[model samples]
Target: MGTADTFIKNRLDERKASGIYRMLKPENSLVDFCSNDYLGFARSAMLKNNIVAEMAHYPDSLNGSTGSRLLSGNLKYAEELEQQIAIFHEAEAGLLFNSGYDANVGLFSSLPQKGHAIICDELIHASIIDGARLSHANRYTFRHNDLESLEGKLKQAKGNCYVVIESVYSMDGDTPPILGILQLTERYNANLIVDEAHAVGLYPAGLISELGLQNRIFARIVTFGKALGCHGAVVLGSNLLREYLINFARSFVYTTAASFHQLASVKMAYELLKEVDDEANVLRNYIFLFKQKLNNNSQYKLLPSDSAIQCIVVNSNGNAKHVSGQLQAAGLDVRAILSPTVATGTERIRICMHSFNTLEQVKLLTSTLNTITHAQ
Candidate 1:
């Protein structure tokens, strides 16, 4: 057999030995407590119509971008979308990437230099970790959301320091102290990069803007796939940073540009998010109620979070997977986040909430979970 086949077989054997082999399943329409479409914009008819309407004004808005963006794929629509995103997020400029993963890799690998140090949270997204690994910078991981620990690491940094974190952590669904992080960044004369993938479109107005920390950070990565109900992500930063990424970020420079349809859809999604105040309010209420219900139930251990994502620690990967499977068999869509994905002893079931999920579904899912766990 070929080298590629042997490599795949070896990897599969390793995973099987570790009891961590994973396989994909067909999409199911069970009550969603797992999708990232927080605002229900993925299925929004109005948003779809708006994209179609925009595309009708330009017939070339379909199909793949012909070549890499550095080549023939550059288009007027991309620039327009980036401008809209930058304005909306209150950044000096925004550069779009194919996905959040691309944005992370592009930013992390390209921003820090050989003499710089990258201090990241131990629990940051895998993409960020991978990017940091690819970077030439010296890297260290502080305790998750522990500013003091990060500060200690900062003191030991040898050169230019970059502090990286997510606004809302994907697995844990908790937020770090933004003001404190910014303070540390300034104190150490370091650059701060925030990945707002889970917070954008769900946070009030502009998340970074709402905190009034727009001008203080080096970059903010806002993703459209999660709460925005679209594909792609944007790295928001200074005009200089945008230009730098255009030239040096391999992920952005080498990949084909996003299609015109995707750009139009992202623009439409942002517009809808801006106008749909009532829907946003409803989502906020649902989140509050969900948290209240989880808190009131003393039987299960819910991670501390105020966002749409929540986790229940089950400790063992096998147990967590079994619990998740039980919930799925009962027609709910909760997912088990296994070890290796998380720390071995910290594996849990991750539940993602959506604005469109009804109160009845939330109540039923909670009750079922309570019963399953024998929670009082």
Candidate 2:
């Protein structure tokens, strides 16, 4: 085999040895417990039918976007929907990207110009971390959700500083004190940017919009694939930032645009979100019920979070995977998030609650978890 083949084989072997080898499994009919579809819109046949019907408005024989949006791919209907989205989210303007990762890459890589500084949380998403690395700006990380640490970093930052954080942290499922952070950003003279990927459908629009801080933020990244149960994301901000990103964000500028059907899916998803706003409460209630079942079981630590993403800290790659396997055997779909996706000692079984999940499912899941953790 070639040298490249040997190198790839060695890397794969290392992952296996460390008990962190990743593989894709076919979709199963297991009970719902590990998906980010907090609103269950992905399973709504009604939403699919509506989206299909909406596609009739576009020109016939269209299988894909002809080119990038800057080229032949920009559909008038799609741009109209972008405006609709911005209005719904209470932002002055919005720009769609092919995916959440693409949006993060485009926004961060392009926004922070040379001589500017980016202060980010230590526990921010991997995509955001990669985005920061791509920027020309100096970057500093404060302790996750620690206001004092962030304040110190803010004070030390140079020129046109930006504070980047997620409205709801992904892995841990905790949220920062956003109002306090906003105050510090104002005091330190830094612009605030939030990734509300996990907070959007749960909150009326997102945390910024929920708090009526739409005018206070520099930018916000909202995704459709999670609670919205569709694909793509948008950067919500002022008209100027939208225009600037369109001109300079290479991820959006150079890549082929998302197909007409995909954009329609995003539009339809938000429309559905508006109709089923009460599902957010259902999901939160399930989260509460699941935690209540745990009831201070000293088996393993359950992370403190009011959101749908609940994590049981198992603290080792092998153990986490084993617990996840046991839950899967019991027809539950709980997933193990191992390190180096997270910190070394924070390997965990990630339980994602959904609006469709019944109270019985939550009880069974927590009971099974209690048993497995006891066996450990």
lDDT for each candidate structure: 0.86, 0.88
The prediction achieving the highest TM-score against the true structure is 2
For residues 197-240, write the lDDT of model 2, one tens digit per residue: 99877785887888888888889999988988889999999999
The sequence of per-residue lDDT tens digits that candidate 1 reaches over residues 221-321 is 99889877889999999999999999999999999889888888898888888876777777778878777765455545789988888888877877787
Runs with alpha carbons beyond 4 Å of true place in candidate 2: 59-61, 374-376
Best by lDDT: 2
For all predicted structures, in order, the TM-scores are 0.95, 0.97
Number of clashes in every candidate structure?
A: 0, 0
